[model samples]
Target: MSLNRRCSRTACGRPAVSTLTYVYADQTAVLGPLATFAEPHAYDLCEVHSERLSAPRGWDVLRLAPDPNAIGPTTDDLLALADAVREAARPVPVTVSAPSAETGREVARKGHLRMLTSE
Candidate 1:
């Protein structure tokens, strides 16, 4: 499901790592992280193009730096992912919940566990 987007600049085939859009009224060029989806008014730029991006005379170019902490998966994230996989791989019990006349349908599903918090 990954998007294989290329730089919008002509003849530059590098992979897009940032998105650029202009604010016509304000005369500003905004360069930010890669957009979730391609926008008609936005242009995709590569690392090189993004670094060398410049605005026209009297225009401002706003560059949004990516968060350093969000660059990669942390150790805790990896461990949590592993734990989730292990939990999902485990076998389920034979007990089945059914609605009975004495009581209404089960308020909550059984056997399915979601990792809501660390604890």
Candidate 2:
């Protein structure tokens, strides 16, 4: 399921692509790419609202660049996944022995795989 946030503008349901926050002290409106987590005081906005955003006539608007890390998974992620799959697929020899008469149970273990004792 997608956890994308929707625009905060009334009547608009588009997914948020940026975040809007005001710096009251500096009289500045900060517009940047959507944050990793939603902030209680910040407003999440869609592409259109973000592009059309404007601060008060005398206030400054600070636009920050999109975060590169939030774009998506990188090559490293795929490489690590591939390595894990390869290691899991690599076969390992397993040794089996007859059940002990005293215990009357059989158990086997190989790598991370385990077999429960059967009476």
Clashes of each: 0, 0
Tens-place lDDT digits, model 2, residues 4-51 = 899999999999988899999999999987876899999999989999
Compute each candidate's TM-score over C-alphas.
0.55, 0.55
Model 1 worst lDDT window (10 residues): 110-119
Off by over 4 Å in 1: 71-119
lDDT of 1 by residue, 43-109 (tens): 9999999999999999999999876667566799899999999999998754445554443444334
Deviation in Å, model 2, residue 91 alpha carbon: 43
Q: Give the TM-score of candidate 1.
A: 0.55
Clash pairs, model 1 backbone: none
Report, for every candidate in turn, its global Cα lDDT versus the true structure. 0.82, 0.83
In candidate 1 the C-alpha lDDT for residue 70 amounts to 74
